[model samples]
Target: MVDGKGKKMSKSAGNVMAPKKIIDQQGAEILRLWVASENYREDIRVSNEILKRLTESYRKIRNTFRYLLGNLNDFDPVKPIGYR
Candidate 1:
């Protein structure tokens, strides 16, 4: 694992990123998405750039869901709504 500064996370180096801290700031879902999106075949860097991009992605995902839900609020399951 690596720190936000791109340094290897180590206890001796005092550069470890605590899970609780990250969860508290960015939420566990974001952390999970970050981990799941990474390619485990190689070393991963957890820098500010990566986090920023992930945050933006998460926002987009959330907005998409919100838009879907909002648009579906007036739809009835018994009747099919034709796509325009």
Candidate 2:
């Protein structure tokens, strides 16, 4: 993985970002999304900006699902209402 500076993450450089630390800070979903969004064919870059953008995307997706689910909270399969 590379850092925001485009340099490889290394313990000697003090830029290592551990998965457990990221999960503890931003939640496992964020970490998982970050990993999923990266291109497996290339080196992944981890930075504050990338994480911030990913978090926003995650929120949008989750909020959309919540809205759709909320609209179905009172839905009944047996009752078919005519469109107004």
Candidate 3:
């Protein structure tokens, strides 16, 4: 894995980022999204900026879903409304 600045992660280098800490601060969903978005064939880079971006993306998707669902508050499945 690589650091956000693209440097190799190392113990002695003091650049290791703990997963538990990230999970506690950002939630596991964000981490999962980050992994799924990366190309795995190369070194994975981690940084505050990347996590922040992912969080924003997650929020956008979640908010969009919430908005779409919110509009269906009065929806009736059995009595579907016909389009005008």
Candidate 4:
């Protein structure tokens, strides 16, 4: 529904990003950061060039998480912390 005018992000458009795609390529963290980086009120565009640049930062985050997980391999948590 482009009347030569830009539209906003919506669930009805069916242009929503798929979870499986995100998990397959970079992982959940990348998708989360990408979503967090944008302003929801404005239109969000997805092009290969943009995704390419974003995925770099995404991969870095994923790598950092991986490293942290590896470093904490031996540690085990007895229970999860609850926020007050």
For candidate 1, the lDDT comes to 0.81
How do the residues 1-84 of candidate 2 rate in per-residue lDDT, one tens digit apiece? Answer: 898777999999889989888888788999999988889788889987888888999999999999999999999999988899
TM-score of model 1 relative to the true fold?
0.76
Q: Which portions of model 1 show Cα errors greater than 4 Å?
A: 4-6, 77-84
Considering every candidate listed, which one attains the maximal TM-score?
2
> Clash number for every model?
0, 0, 0, 0
lDDT of each: 0.81, 0.90, 0.93, 0.64
Worst 10 residues of 2 by lDDT: 40-49
For lDDT, the strongest prediction is: 3
lDDT of 1 by residue, 4-41 (tens): 55578888987776768778888888789889998788
Looking at candidate 4, the ten consecutive residues that score lowest on lDDT are 1-10
Q: Work out how many backbone clashes candidate 4 has.
A: 0
Candidates arranged by lDDT, highest first: 3, 2, 1, 4
**TM-score, model 4 to reference:** 0.46
Residue pairs in clash, model 1: none
